[model samples]
Target: MAVVVGFIPTPVGFAALEAAQREAERRGGPLIIVNVVRDGMQGDPRHADQGQLERAQDMVRRASVRIAVRQEHTDDDISDVLLQVVEEEKAELLVLGIRRERDMASHLLGVTVQKLLTSSPSDVLVV
Candidate 1:
């Protein structure tokens, strides 16, 4: 139905958006970006400021492709939110921004990344 992307304002996040947009265009579907902030998170640069969000919207506008951006702060885990959006939109693909893992203990390859990879119902693209 659409390409759902987990978005922040980070470099990997931007990369995910770009790749998802291209994939959506190729699939003839719209792009849906889910920008999220974990509840009570403070000063996390990942959460875009109003200016940054507006800029992202402007960029999407210039790209001239059908897109929907949803920003929210949730008490639930980020991975859960992403998976929920995928089902809500009936997304065929899920794009995510990922950073390399540092250790092999319980921490795992970024907890949320691992969670989403294992749990999402749609095809996942880690950018």
Candidate 2:
């Protein structure tokens, strides 16, 4: 099973990516990075640009495990997209990143994280 990580273009997201890479390496499994772009949110800061994705790919390539980066565009809930990926990939673990803001706990309790926490078949890790 792969290690699946939800990736956004943020510091927290990169941290999650790194952690997921380590987990994948430890498990001798592939790493799948899922970057979901909400419909009409292509310009959103959270959506990663091609350069950023390339950089992320380069970072992951430095490790020994295989890597796949998927940039999915959808109108559905982000959590749904991630859960679908988890099921499709038969992921052993799902990792997410949360911003370190004043209301960090609120971000942790957000709909996407909460949904995955309750609904995902694989283990969930938030970094």
Candidate 3:
């Protein structure tokens, strides 16, 4: 079974990675860490591409995580790509990090975690 972890643009992303790593380790399943590059950067494509991806890779490396890491570009909302990956990869579990916010309006409006939890057919684990 594949464990899919969604990497967002916050510390929560790393937290999610850590939690997923632990769960994957326990379950003895392959883990795939994916960071969705959202559209809208007014700089060199190479720089924009490498900036976030490299950091994410470094985090995995530093964590000594034994998992496959993939970086993907998406023009659509983050939730869209996340759900697509879940289906395409046949992920049995989805893990994400959600920052606690007092403003429920923001999350209810359209947060990635919320959308993933509601839309995913498989089990979702939010750290």
Candidate 4:
């Protein structure tokens, strides 16, 4: 089984990749980097651009783990895409970047995070 990481072009995304690298190393497994966007979506600030994806690939290559990077455009929710990655990749763990929010609405947790925490069979690591 591989280690799966949700990736974007932000610092938090980098942190999640780093953490995933360590986990993959420890497990002696491949790394699956996943970036998902809604079908036909454009210019979403949360998604990574081509250049950023290339940089992320370089980083993964340098990490020396067997790697697969998937930029998937899906109609499904991001959480479902992530969970699908976990199942399809047979991932041992799922890693994601998270930023703390003080807003009361956010205290309930984001929909994606909540769905994964409740539905995922694999362990999750939030970095």
**Top of the candidates by TM-score:** 2
Write one digit per residue (lDDT tens) for candidate 4, span 1-127. 5899989888889989989998998898799999988776778866888899889888878766798889988877998989998999889999988764445357337788889878887999877
Residue 58 lDDT (model 4): 86
Q: What lDDT, from 0 to 1, does candidate 3 have?
A: 0.72
lDDT tens readout by residue for model 3, 5-107? 8876467777887788777666665778887776674352322255665666676664433677777777677788878888987888899876676465565
Q: Could you list the CA RMSD of all candidates, in the order they appear?
A: 2.6, 1.1, 3.8, 2.0
Whole-model Cα lDDT per candidate? 0.81, 0.91, 0.72, 0.85
Clash pairs, candidate 1, are none
Of candidates 3 and 2, the better by TM-score: 2
lDDT of 2 by residue, 34-70 (tens): 9999997657887998999998898888878889999
Clashing pairs in 2: none
C-alpha RMSD of candidate 4: 2.0
Q: Report the CA-based lDDT of candidate 1 relative to the real structure.
A: 0.81
Can you tell me which runs of candidate 3 are displaced by over 4 Å?
41-55, 58-66, 101-111
TM-score per candidate, in order?
0.87, 0.95, 0.75, 0.90
Off by over 4 Å in 1: 100-108
Clashes of each: 0, 0, 0, 0
